[model samples]
Target: MVDNRVNPTSNMKLLLYNQVDGRCPFCGKNLHYVKNQIQTLLEIAHIYPANPKSHEAELLKDVPRLSEDVNSMENLIVACRDCHKKFDHPRTAEDYYRWYDLKKELMLNDEAKSAFFDNNVEEDIIKVMDSLLKIECESDLVQLSLSALKLDEKINKENSFIFRKKIRDQVVDYYPMVREQFNELDAISPYQFEKIATQVKGCYLTLIKINENQEAVFRMLVAWLDEKTGKISSLACEIIISFFIQNCEVFS
Candidate 1:
């Protein structure tokens, strides 16, 4: 009983594609379903096809009756053209479920990476500081200038002992600061960080200029914000501002 009346709104279709990472869960192909694809190549695959009496429903007999929401986001996933056909085939429910679980894990990690790279946390921080301090942003971006110092500290605390040393070595080579004097950049509020870096490190750290490598780091951060998902939420912006304000590092 393939009911041909299923129609999903454009918005719901986009939401499903994003949730599925714009790929077929089974074949993991983006095909024409890419974000900017001229024409959508994805089809909405329902775990429980609209008509409960359809052949696909036979496999979902184990699903609780009350839990069934045929149109719910939980019951739908986006699939590439070929995968969609295979998914609609009877007796493939179990296989699709496995891919769905994997998609969830993949999306979770995607979110974490977004928080680190794609989310424009750094740029938003700059806009905030500029407005709050009433100063126009200069050439030195959040990532371009002091994050060079903050990187080592974040890596050290986040990594293991041996791992920490290896990462620190990379940062040293990348930015090559004169001394590791500005390690506490993100330890407190941005105001305090500015106070310390400007008042204290400005005297000594400025002596060691930014090398090509540090500039490259700055470009990388900029590109990430540009290429990745849009900037973080208003709440995230506030959190970063507060982190800049409340954080304190004694490495001075």
Candidate 2:
């Protein structure tokens, strides 16, 4: 059979390697090996088979594909040789869906990172983090009734049950205190709360544009805020994000 697979350029290879962080997304093995000399062990695998055999084509015909063009960047991934071979042979619907989901996650992560540079929250958002960290007494924390949580209304069915439960728990634990802190910040400096809320909303809007999955956007928002706040507790970021969801700054 004539080989029709086009070899990826050096730049494309590098981009693929970087996207997987120099490791095989499937096996978690390093893409390179170094003993006597550095050797590359990575293979660019197609998320959708480029040239499926008759049986392979039939198997995947109804499966969702990342792109119609199998050679597109959206349909490529960096995998170690072993995983590449394993995934290609005996390509069951289960394995196809698994790889498809993994590639989609990687793409979402890359888009989220790129979007962070354009839409970022202000440093003033850190004040909320500081307040969370400074709490010395359990009495300082405020709780809300479970019935008051808006996560169900704000979040779509795309969100996982675990994520929904987590956001609900955080909102129940910190909603009132976070709201009070924002109100106090506004009192001290007029529009401070609005400024911070607007920045977060902008970031959320930018992320949703990349991927509308509520859980994906929520996770990206927490990650962006965590970085902006100098790597503060992710729990604090989650609480703040939940607060904004309640305030209609996000998921609205």
- State which candidate has the highest lDDT: 2
Q: What total of clashing residue pairs does each candidate reach?
A: 11, 0
- Encode model 2's per-residue lDDT on 29-120: one tens digit a residue: 99898989999999999977888888998988899889887888888999999999999887888999999999999999988666444333
TM-score of 2: 0.50
lDDT score, candidate 2, position 236: 87
Per-residue error (Å), model 1, residue 152: 12
lDDT (Cα, tens digit) per residue for candidate 1, span 72-185: 665676778787676666446576566557546655765655544422334434444334344245332232244443545433253356644533443333222211122333
TM-score of each: 0.43, 0.50
List the global CA lDDT of all models: 0.46, 0.85
